[model samples]
Target: MTAAILADALTQKVHQTEIDKELQALKEQAMVSGTEDSILVNKRQGAADLLGSLRLPHKRDEEWQFTDLSELKAIDFVAAGKVSLDVAAAENFYLPEAHQSRLVFINGFFTPELSNTNDLPSAITCQSWTNLAAHQREQLANYLGQKTDGNEVFSNLNTAGMTDSGVVWIPANIELKSPIHLLFLTVVDPTPIMVQPRLLVVVENNAQVTIAESYGAITTNCTDRPQQQPYFNNIVSEIYLGENAQVTHIRNQRDSGDSFHIATTAIAQGKQSRYQLIDVNLGAKLSRHNLQMAQRGEGTQTEFLALTTLAGRQVSDTHSTIALNHPHGVTNQLHKCIVDEYAQAVFSGKVLVPQAAQLTNAQQLNRNLVLSSKARINTKPELQITADNVKCSHGATISQLEADEVFYLRSRGLNDYDARHLLIDAFAGEILDQIPLASLQGRLRQCISCRTI
Candidate 1:
């Protein structure tokens, strides 16, 4: 063999060894946590078997070219142990809008004391996997870890180590007036650890509901600290919308800057169903989110709005794919990113319209604002269309804050800082304003101000 070929083989061997070691450590952690359900045990074993063959994503891969995982690979992380928090302290993470309709998980373990699902309507069932009845567990075995194709390694890793999940079920023809919140909080640990949190939501035919999913850290001041230790949070969420059902999903991620977060959200829409998503990402040392939507029936409609804000040396990446498999499908997506300092942001959005998807209308756009010369943004908006009668378009834009607009704002009696912030707010507001909750919008606006200023 040539010298280069020999080196490549050696590198592959080393990578495989590392992956095996990590998987074994995670499996040990899962054993410590323990699983009571047979379904969970079978799923975990299957995932573990698959994870052994898959290696960590490398820069050589097309999907992970711009995002680096070396920092994550360097740490030896064990599974997180059960951490408890005072009810009063956990209340700090609750939202006023979902005060009575929230489900809380700490370090991937369901904490019933910190959760409130008592005020929900009778048609809605919100509980954790550990609390599910036998019939319910049997029914859920068909949906959990079944939405995605199971090609991504991080997602499979989550399934392999997952101990519990937050489940939401809405019966047919039911409409909820309030939103349900799923709060997953990670506490700073002295030793590096990993947590896998899972969620599943099923809305039956003609049912309507709104979901608020959030991931954050439990800090003394509710902010990143200098002594914060590094940890890993791997999460997966699956949502199924039945025929004619309507569901609105809001997801927010604000982990500690010293932590690593990887998440996947898989959504399936049935005939004439309407699904909308508003995703906001703000904090993490390194973060990646995979958002996938599949149309299971004809005449389905989907709307996606995403906003990402980064400062310091944080790295954030978002990959979204919308598959139109049936006829008369409609999809619209808008993603915006604001990067400052030495931070980097990456976005790759793909819209697939096959021959069966006639009369499909899809629009995708990605806009980015770079504050410093060193800050970087990598964006790719792609549309793969085979149907001739489809209307599809995808585009991306990357530019600094327009000097002309900033100057005009300054000329209107605004100082330099105020002028710059105004322009940034306007740019981000286009997506943030569409969020359903007023309190969340206000909080996000403040977070943007703090990061940009």
Candidate 2:
């Protein structure tokens, strides 16, 4: 019995030793891609240590109760540090001249070689955030991570590895005549590429700008086989809208189906500012998006929308939070999810109004259309309002394809499968149509239409 106990104790120690080595490897990567920000490093190290303590999720953590990450833990994925891409490979993302300010990142590092700026409008200056003028960087550091408290483990990791990320600044009162188009390329797939997209948009008072961001993969890697089972795409986005600044933002993700994607986007909008955010997710095996926004100024307006279509064994989870700390602030959010096959989906939204925030207007609507009964969707909408004068509402609905809608389409001479697909497309149209850029709108619509039962 003493010998057996010693053997077991030794096994446990060896296992822990391997885990610590793995975490240290991740930390070394952060040190290699150095960021001058000391605060970011301290926070990142703390987060890494904390996450190392918790076991990988297994459908138990309340926030991640629905999606299962078992497949990711089973494989050994390589860390993808830096990559390169040519200009021609980015043809799929062709934004018109009217909205064609470009910022390109190849393998999470800003690549000037893959970017185009000749056709950019004179009013909008297109350049890498890392190369920003000295004054701009100082001003940006003030509000860089202010909106996000590093609430999640993933955000802290990205914060520590911030050297590769970029920023976009629309100086105060500079109305961008066109929408800025930012692109990130993830090549070197088979080796389990890890891509981190970092972004910050500062729209100062009376500044008006529109941004369209998209991601794509360039290389297919079979060099490492199954060990590279789970590729990582970790993205962090921060947007700051000053008083009376009107900004519209859109993000599109079309990545490898085997990829594991986790993203956090936090926005801060000032008084009387109007900001709208739209997220389009059509890829990834296990994907989650954290959308958190805060309204600090009065009379601010925000519109948030998301549209996702899942199939096969894919899973997508979206957690959104809208906090109103000031009086007379307004926010509206809507999420539409479509799941098929044996896939699962989840949507959680929380709206808060503090006692000091009187006359706040907030509402959340979550709708899901499950094509197969086996395909599941879970939605939790929570509201916490401490202000007696606040007006807040939240509602969630989950249903399958309506027979009548399919029948009406079938009456138009379409097959049952075609009819079902058409109705689902229509349901997602409302959210995709919210994209102001015509190219972006059409591309998102096409992605939605290509979904299969």
Candidate 3:
């Protein structure tokens, strides 16, 4: 063999050894907080076995070329222990719209004391995985950890270490009047910790529901540090929409600025189903979100609206894939990013229309605004169409605030900072207006105002 080839092989072997060691340590940690549910036990073991042979993704990988995991690898994190909090103390995190229909998880474990689900309708079933009934367990087995891109390593790691999950099931033909909230909170610790949180939502045929999911960090009395401690949050969510179902999903990620957050959301839509997603990313020193959606039946409709705001030295990456496997599918996506200071933002959106998916209409656009010379933005919007009759278009743009527009705003009797802030707000208002909840929209508007100032 050539000397270069020998060196490459040695590098691969070393990486594989490191991967194995990491997997073993995670598995041992999982066993300490293992679940008694038989189905979950089997699922965990299966994922652990699969992880044994897979290596961590690196810059050499195509999908992760722009994301660097070196900082994450440097921290040796242990599993977070079960912690308790008073319900009254967590009032600040509660939303008035979902006061009675919320589920709260702390450090990846369901916290019954801080959750309120007593006012939910009979058509909905919401509970933790450990509290699932026999029939529910049987149904969950069919979908849990099943719908994925099939190559997400962090997702598999979540399954391997998951001891509990938030499950939401809506029956057929039922329309929920209020939105359900899923709140996952991470607590900072003196020692770096790792937490895996999982969620499963299943909507039956002709059902309609709205979901608001969020992730944030909290501090306890004993540990009053200001979110400076490092932690890792690995999350996985699976959503299944039956035929003619309608689901509106809103996701918000506002973790600690010193933490690492990685998430995967896999969605499947049945015939004539409608799925709409409004995603907002605002925090975390380093974060990545992988969103995958597949149309399982004809006449499905999908919509995605995302906004990412980053500052300081933060890095945020979003990768989305929409597959139209059936005919008569329709999809529209718009992603926007605002980067300031030395922050960096990355976005890659892929739309696939195969030959079998005739008469598909798809549109994708990515827009970015840079506020500093050191700020960076990377965006790629792609459409792979094999269907001759499909109407598909994709485009991306990365630019700074328009000088002419800013000057025009300044002429309207506004200061330079106010002019720039107004322009930035207008850029973000397009996506924020589409959100279904007025309260959330107002909150997000305030957040944007503070960030710009």
Candidate 4:
């Protein structure tokens, strides 16, 4: 390789030494602060140990072949402690639909005053992990901090840094009339910091609930130059659904343009359970989502839908995996991305149907639209089926806007910008229309209409 190439490689190399030093500093700070309970302290220590032995994932990893963490490596991250919330500052981020059941967290710390759960039914319990009783903590020990062992450097790092989490439990045979919303707000911090927000949900047999999770930043005082604070949000969510349970999960990531976000959602479903997830990504300098789901029981149905819109120098990557472990399982997944300016989008969807997953039906599709000559998209769909009786298919497509359609709209007395916006709205409506909450749907549509740099 040439000298320039060698220099680039050096810069791209994983900064494991610096990352370890930061981790050690955080551990020392945790010990000195001594603000957390033994349960959480032990969990963080275990996760820190695991992360100490590993390095952040890079483009060399098979699952991360399209995404790079050079920007993340360049940052010197510190722990984000609790910050005083200006009630007026957080009002703009609340959702009216979930006004009665919303949970608010600032910089990954739960704020009870901003959260409303008083009108919720007695059967439904929503509380923060740090407030749980001793017995409750003991009950969740087996589930917390337990994930697929190695190669998950970010997940481990998140666990090590996790201080508190949100927990929701629904009893059997109950259905929530309205959706539960979680609002994670990142305020301006003088020092660059990282926050890990954890969520755990458990639904008993024959229960049903809807959850909407959103992320945003607090703006400064200047209206003319609304600047966003730089921060990193590493979030993890674990969901468990019992037999005949149903769940609708909608997550939106709209952070600051100067921020970084990495999130993972792990789900386990029981027999005859139904689950659907609608994921939307619109902000952040670099954002990635890892979705892993397993159908552990027979006759399960799962659906995953995602939409990514990027402009300027933004980058978005989504990697998802679905495993069918039992017979009579069905899955349908569709992911779409719209890129403009100098942005880039990446999608990787994989479905696995093992020998035991006979009579499985799976379909996966990835589609991308590039609105600018400088924009780029990389999409791939993988299907591995060993069951002879399974029906599985996967495909991908990348295309630019149709010139004839643009011309038709232009002839209808609409300007170029208007025509383009109309077409993009229609393109994104397919996924936006599926959002069950009208308030959330409208909010997302409005966000999609605005152009961000």
For 1-453, candidate 1 gives per-residue lDDT tens digits of: 112211222233323444445445545665676536677767766775676566778999999999998878767676777788988767766888888999999988898989998779865789998788878999889988887656787787778666679999999999998889899998877887788899999999999999999888887654543346888888899999999999999999989889888999999999999999999999888999999999999999999999999999989999999999999999999999999999999999999999999999999999999999999999999999999898888899999988898889888899999999998999999989988888888988998898898
Per-residue error (Å), model 3, residue 26: 11
Q: Roughly what TM-score does model 4 have, to 2 decimal places?
A: 0.90
lDDT of 4 by residue, 141-202 (tens): 76676643345877776676666789888888999887889889888576666777898888
Error of 1 at 348 (Å): 0.7
RMSD of model 4 against the true structure? 5.2
TM-score per candidate, chains pooled: 0.92, 0.86, 0.91, 0.90
Top candidate on lDDT is 1
Local accuracy of candidate 2 as per-residue lDDT tens digits, 1-453: 012211222132223344345445545654575533444444445544544443444577898888776665554444455555556766666577432467788778887766766655554546755566556566666766566654465675565445545677777788777677888767745555566678878888999988888876664532111223457777888888999999888888776677778888889989999999888888777889988888878899988888888887878999988888889888899988888888888999988888978998888899988888799888898998889997789898989989998899899999998898778778888888788888778877766666664
- Whole-model Cα lDDT of every candidate shown, in order: 0.85, 0.72, 0.84, 0.81
| Global lDDT of model 3 | 0.84
Residue 243's lDDT within candidate 2 is 93
Comparison by lDDT, 3 against 4, better one: 3
Say which prediction, candidate 1 or candidate 2, comes out ahead on TM-score.
Answer: 1
For candidate 3, write residues 156-238 as lDDT tens digits: 77876666789999999999988999999887887877888999999999999999998888865311113668898889999
Residue pair clashes in candidate 2: 190-221
After superposition, candidate 3 runs with Cα above 4 Å error: 1-35, 220-226
Per candidate, the number of residue pairs that clash is 0, 1, 0, 0
RMSD of each: 5.1, 6.0, 5.4, 5.2
In angstroms, the error of model 3 at 60 is 1.3
The local distance difference test score of model 1 is 0.85
